[model samples]
Target: MRYVDFTSEELWKQFLPGDHLALDTIVKRHYNLLYQYGCKFTRDAALVKDCIQDLFLYLWHRRNTINETASVEHYLMKALRRRLARALSKSGSMEGIGFLEFKDVAASPDEQLIQQEQKAALADKIKKCILQLSRRQQEIIYLRFYLNASAADIADIMQLNRQSVYNLLNDALNKLRQHTGAYFKPAMALSIILLLVLSQL
Candidate 1:
């Protein structure tokens, strides 16, 4: 079967019926995205991989009991987030880590070096600003901007009301602007632009 044309919900339906190919396809579709999001929570790549593996294994084992969800991405993300939380708590690691990978887009070698330094400096500042946010606020910013999730999706993932998600997102952006006042232009919110850049990376 050509799973490439299937939506996540379609693949999920197949997986629920014990279709191994569908399960494999789902893993392929989401693994990289899940890995990137997982890394933001902790610096341990191995742990993130393990948690993703465990999440899929858990799904497979309980496929019959799992209900359909609006977003397969959000469901998997929420599950992975919980698993990472548990693992981090067990290991006494800080739950939030700002790990971003960026590419240099300069033309010349000297220019590339200059751009790399500037981008690195900006990334450091963004990381510090993100870390200063309350955990809930940080997560709201991440899901809204980095994941490009809608308020409804965020509410579903975070188990909050839609209005609460909106309020948190507003509050988080305000705090981010305050924290990043130097980098932010008066007309632009640095959190949105910077998070979008990081998401692409």
Candidate 2:
């Protein structure tokens, strides 16, 4: 059905009408993103995969009742987060699942060689600084910068007020700057660059 060229909104609309191909495309497009987000909460790959499958099954069963969202990725992320939280709580492992680990950025050999060592070092430091933040702070930073989510989308996903999301992001960025010993401008610039690099993977 050439769903590959369809926008997320179009695919979602088609799915709501019980188009199996549309649903399949939607899942394929978003599965990796949901899995990465799920990993931020828990290191158990099997558990994360199960929760994502459950989320899709639930969505398919309730397609007609589901509300349209501005961003399908955000909606799926929020749903997956809720599903994972419930599963973890049931297993009494919620406390062990909130840490966010930073992975080394992937770069082509040419790109890696072109990047300055000092800039790479600063980016690495910024990544470490992000890990030092509280769990909530790290989540907000990931959503806001890495996912390029709007404040409203973040608030919806995090179940917080829009203003709270803004405040939390501001606080997190401030902490990153302070922890890195960089001025606000440079810290922010470095963070945006590093996050963009990480998000590509």
Sliding window of 10 residues with minimal summed lDDT for model 2: 106-115
Candidate 2 ranges with C-alpha deviation above 4 Å: 96-99, 103-115, 182-201
Across 78-160, the per-residue lDDT of candidate 2 in tens digits comes to 89998998899889976534645556654333344234555556566666776677888778877777788889888999888
Which structure among the candidates has the greatest TM-score? 2
lDDT of each: 0.74, 0.78
Q: Model 1, 104-184: lDDT tens per residue? A: 322222343235555445555556666666667766776776678999888887778999988877886776667766665
Please estimate how well model 2 matches the true structure, expressed as its whole-model Cα lDDT: 0.78
* Stretches > 4 Å off in candidate 1: 94-131, 177-200
TM-score of every candidate relative to the true structure: 0.74, 0.85
lDDT for 146 in candidate 1 is 68
**Candidate 2, 79: how far from true, in Å?**
0.6
Model 1 RMSD vs true structure? 5.1
Reference-based TM-score, model 1: 0.74
